[model samples]
Target: MDPEILKFKILVLGDSGTGKTSIVRRIIRDEFSLVHSATVGVDFSVKVLNIAQGLEIRLQLWDLAGQDRFNHLSRLYYKQASGVLLVCDETKPDSLDSIVKWKGELDARLQYKIPAVLLVNKTDLIDDEDEGFSEDDLEKICSRLRIGSWSRTSAKDGFGVNECIKALVWDILSDKESKTPDPLTKTKDVFDWDDDCSSSIIRLGRQDLDLANSRGRARKCCH
Candidate 1:
């Protein structure tokens, strides 16, 4: 049996009502609901996978609230992420435009540069008459930002969702192999909780790891 790999963190970011949570739930549970309440501060899930390299990796995926009120809280989650999934609603042009700002925020807050994947979600909602954007437009935007890869998906229909994540995991692992010193091997001390219930808190790093593992399994199974 392969030694279990330490979990890696992946942040999912997008504007409000962009189906970030829906995509995650579909991948994690193989189930989807019409009603998914807005993420309060932050939420996470975990999945584990046994891949081709004799590696068992834990993927911790983080879903940060996209409301403006939570904008200030994003950096706290972005600080030590291993990768980022920048999701956009395919039906909303402005949501797509917001990727530029998201990229800037990641650059400013992260300690180390991390790979990013762009997901144009809700493709199922697009109509034949809607010609304002195309795969070419998304490609140009991703190329400009140097995103690792881009996927056009419909979270509602489960199209391209799995392929996008699998590509991301492969890219992350490949990037680690190409580096001189493995960037992801470093681990920090776990968080210490306060004795008082009112002061209790969960560590963001731990949440990140749990989500990555869960997302990784969703990807593998989807494939």
Candidate 2:
């Protein structure tokens, strides 16, 4: 018999009201919430996907709370994360501004490099010329941060959300084969501290570390 396929953990990080929860709900449960409620701590769900080559994979998605006080709790979820869905609300420019911080937190706590997909959520809200951010802006941001993959999604309409998740999963699995290195071993090499490059990477690393430490303390408090 073939060995059991390993399960991959994908973390969703973004500012509050960015629709991180909505995307997850739409994908996992085929549900969407018109009245948004802040996620108290963290929410989780799982889905099985079949990729190319008949590879069956289980994705354990952890959705972290985007509030400032709950930010510290994110580190615990990142420990063994295989990938991240960094979400930003396309309708709100301020949420886009916080993307740098969210990405940094993931890098520091996990201390490992993982495939990241920047998701510009609420695409359905784009009203003609009123859309604040453009596809070009997203490309520039991702290029600067070395986040090569990205997608525009509308959880309300279920547009491009599933495709984004599948694409991310495939990318992660593909990287896994090429690197042939454990997640922890691959972290340092993935992030480079270059002054010429955008400061986004460094910011992400520091925030991740801080959140990780904070989560550790929180765990102790629980016990």
Candidate 3:
């Protein structure tokens, strides 16, 4: 069976120092790095995720710089974007508040709102509720911003990373199913398992002939 493969350009956005790069590094490499240097303009990477027995998706992660200076460069990468990941630092309230702007800019550029997930990163805090926005606030933000749902994630410890992204991928799949076929989706080239049956039969026949010859040689030696 030829599995279907869907490729999507997912945009990741947040204010500067909101752990956007950290989340990207964690998802892309499965390893956390302390260095959170500001992305120059845009950082691109691809991740192939298996969905079912054969279905898969290629997520093209476009990590947009959080700096206001790069705001002009944001539109350049907005084309063909199928999903979005709006991240916020759980330890920084301002960073979380800036998600609204990111959401607004994304909605403004895209013809239609694609699937989006809001992520609260750095949730290893002892008292996250007190230190940052509360769960109630996050829900309200998600509802107001038109995001489907929100999740708590710790990129440093790799908590809730894959689950959140998988949720978004599923949403993208559902969205595409309800409408026109996604241009990015295509059937994967499947191997022809039965095409070599004749070759296998020939090899087995040769093996059996060799075995008979060895048996004949043993009989001659015994005689």
Candidate 4:
């Protein structure tokens, strides 16, 4: 018997040139485009992920435009969001500052906080000899924003891309399980965290079903 499939919307919000689109492409298609143009409004792609094995989740990834001109339309995309990836470019210090605005807009439009993970992108640009954003600094920011988890990723090389998806998806599932009224069903919630790599390895969230990833055509909007 086939298990019921659930649909979820994951919003990727960040400033211009923060590699929001690249992150999505890396996770969904495992491909990255260096010459990708800036998003005019909102561009989105779809991917169906099999969780544990029993639960199938359709992730509608919405990459919102970062330009101020398109800010007025942000509310339309924030509706019914299941999770959020608040992205920022690690090499560009200014990109970190822009995260505040993105979060502010999300709060104003959604009127409530949704489960989110902060993606510090472009980690490859940082010097291997030098450190960027100390652990204390990152902890302070995440704590202030109430982020569930964070990862240092390199969309260009696919360093932490898989971790990003796993973390956010786990949060979404945990959130849903807490709200579920059925006490008969048990949620498999055991996961191991790698502090050095800052990623999660889910071991027990298994199901008796087939898992697959679907590549769906995406729609782009230009203003």
RMSD of each: 10.9, 14.0, 18.7, 9.5
Tens digit per residue, CA lDDT, model 4, 1-223 = 6855878899999988889999988877888889989988998898775444354567899998888998787778999999899898887888887887787778778876678777888878877625555445555677777777677778999876676677677667778877788721424533332234312222223331111222111101110
Candidate 4 TM-score to native: 0.81
Model 2 per-residue lDDT tens digits across residues 1-223: 3423658899998998889999998878767879877888999898764322223457888998888888667658788899888899888998877988887777778766888777788978876654557656776777766564667778998766765675566567667867775553333332222344432111112223211122111000100
- Index of the highest-TM-score prediction: 4
Candidate 2 clashing pairs, residues 3+ apart or interchain: 104-204, 105-208, 109-208, 113-187
What does the lDDT read for residue 133 in candidate 1? 56
Query: What is the Cα-based TM-score of model 3?
Result: 0.77
Q: Tens-digit lDDT track for model 3 on 164-185?
A: 6766765676677668655434
Give each model a TM-score.
Answer: 0.77, 0.75, 0.77, 0.81
Off by over 4 Å in 3: 181-223
| Superposed model 4: Cα runs more than 4 Å off | 129-131, 183-186, 189-223
Give the Å shift of residue 96 in candidate 3. Answer: 1.9
Model 1 agreement with the true structure over 105-160: per-residue lDDT tens digits: 88888766788888878877766635435656766787787787777677787777
Q: Give lDDT per model, in order.
A: 0.68, 0.68, 0.70, 0.71
Model 2 misplacement above 4 A: 1-4, 50-54, 181-223
lDDT of 4: 0.71
Full ranking by TM-score: 4, 3, 1, 2
